[model samples]
Target: MATPGTLVLAGTPIGRVEDASPRLARELAEADVVAAEDTRRLKRLTTELGVTVGGRIVSYFEGNESQRTPALLEELEAGRRVLLVTDAGMPSVSDPGYRLVAAAVAADVPVTTVPGPSAVLAALAVSGLPVDRFCFEGFLPRKQGERARRLAALAGEERTMVFFEAPHRTEAALAAMAEAWGDDRAAAVCRELTKTHEEVRRGPLAELAAWASDGVRGEVTVVVAGAGPEPGVAADDDSLRAAVDEREAAGMTRKEAIVEVARSAGVPRRVVYNLVHSKGPR
Candidate 1:
């Protein structure tokens, strides 16, 4: 009987090539069709592994993923053991190959994975921050305003956050994060992980932003501490009103003013608003 068709989604080394798993090398050498995000990188990896590709190879990157998925799926349906790889890390985690994997699954083709290195987990593990509850935010939007807005939305998020960023924009992103999440928030910038010049810089957001201002290089992963506990409540109604009035005087609208006082005083917004209205101005 002929071998059943299957789709293998393999994880490549995020940094050092030595991190590649034995199973990855074997699959690459034996796959009947290899779809890679970067054919050049795939070729180099195969050469480094001393594993000759015994199958047809094709490019499948962000630009060509839509066009390539169907073609790769066709190969899989034809009883070809199609193996998908990305430039780095797992194929489909902030990389190409997800669509192809989904297609194979819908078609009832066997789907499997060759697990290996991951920058997200690596950064989280080394970061002194809590990793018990976290979320992978992938890469932030490139536009400055959009990125700031996205970061602002997460200001109240209680879970630790992981983000991938380019070297050149790391400083700007860190600065925006500081503005949205307070300068004192703790964070770590992990650069060139697993490589000879690997570095993990940990500090308050402001300090990390300052370091990156001088310019950063290599792949970067950032792990940030989650929002801290809310502050203690104001001692009395007079103190809470004074806080709200101070915020309102600073040009914040009434609702914004109330929210500010609530967050700072660790009181509910509705409660603050009721007190302000009951006290009737001043």
Candidate 2:
């Protein structure tokens, strides 16, 4: 039986090709097959790094990820060293590499990663928010209703939240965040990270939304402070159900509504859940 091959998930520079590491260049040149999210971007990266890759380069992007994962898996099972690189940051991170990596792992093929630049961490560091406990939310839903529900569920999250947004949608996203999380909620907008035009703006959510109204360009990362400790508001049973009902009416699942109410009311989730289900004394 032939030995299974290795699957290497190499992180690419989020911006500024100079950030590309020497090991990345070496791996790019040595891989048996190079799977890139954007082959053209990969070419540019290789050119900038002054490295030439002799391996076969294949396109593995979002549209083709499902269709191409099986073929990539075959390469791994055939004992070929396959390296995956996304357009920026790391593969499988709001990028196309998870399907192949998961397939490779399921088949017992060795999977490794070459850590490189990450927008999530970079934004978190520059956002000046509490990073000890933070959650990478990646990108929120594009649709207004879906995005609102998603944000509603996160209303009580106590950990710092990081989100990625497209240049065009940034203003709308900031507005939605301000509406859901509160106008005065502290947050930061990091744009064109690591690039020459890099900019980071820190202020309340409403302020950031207003600033973005003028238009934002380049890759954007948003970091928002988590909710402060529960207000322990002296809310009543009717008030709790009312809160849950309002969220449920806004497209959030009943369970999600319960959790949100519990969080914002400083009550236990189980208590809120039981109250809604009529299991607890009203």
Candidate 3:
């Protein structure tokens, strides 16, 4: 009988390589096999850290993930420790690793992690938005109509929203967000975070949209303020839905309209939300 090897999901620095942990270095040097999102990036990181990888290096990116997962899982079942690292951040975050992790878990292989810097948390921390609760909406749909529908669906999302966008699409994303979340809504655009030229532009969605219109660069993370209801507004079942529609048409977030309507009508936010969004007869 042999012990099943452990699978390590290691986190890498989003930008500044110095943020890589000592534990990551140790794991990189000692693992029996390494599955990297970008083998080239992993090479650079190892060179910078002055650590020579003793493991069998394997490419495991989105393109080859489905094909490569089984090979890695075989190593795990063979009692060979496998380490997984993405180009940046933890694996499985809009990145590779989920498939392999799932396979390993299903096989009852031990799974562990090496925590490191994360752009999501770093951006959220500096976003200046309410961080008590937040959701990570990884890259939006590229098409205009699809993106619009996605943003519209989240119109009632009150928890601060965090999104990753390409530099080229930053302007469009901001513009869509402004239309959906309202131009007056506060937001922060974080670019090249933790690296030289890192910039955090905080302002209303309209302002950010205009600023990005000139073009932006590097990795982009956009954080938007959550919608809250206005102080005075009324709500009945029909009125609630109507109120949200009116405010949304006027560029207020659906959640903001709901909150305002509930407060004025002396109703709970959830009750108001159900009335506004429920499809069946109320």
Minimum summed lDDT over a 10-residue window in model 2 is located at 227-236
Best by lDDT: 2
Compared with the true structure, model 3 gives a TM-score of 0.81
Expressed as tens digits, the lDDT of each residue in 116-202 for candidate 3 is 888899999998767888899999999999999999998988788899899999999999998886766778999999999999998
> Measured by TM-score, how close is model 2 to the native structure?
0.81
Cα miss at 88, model 1 (Å)? 1.1
True-structure Cα RMSD, model 2 = 10.6
Residue 102 displacement in candidate 1 (angstroms): 1.8
Candidate 2 CA-lDDT value:
0.88
Candidates' C-alpha lDDT: 0.86, 0.88, 0.86
In candidate 3 the C-alpha lDDT for residue 40 amounts to 95
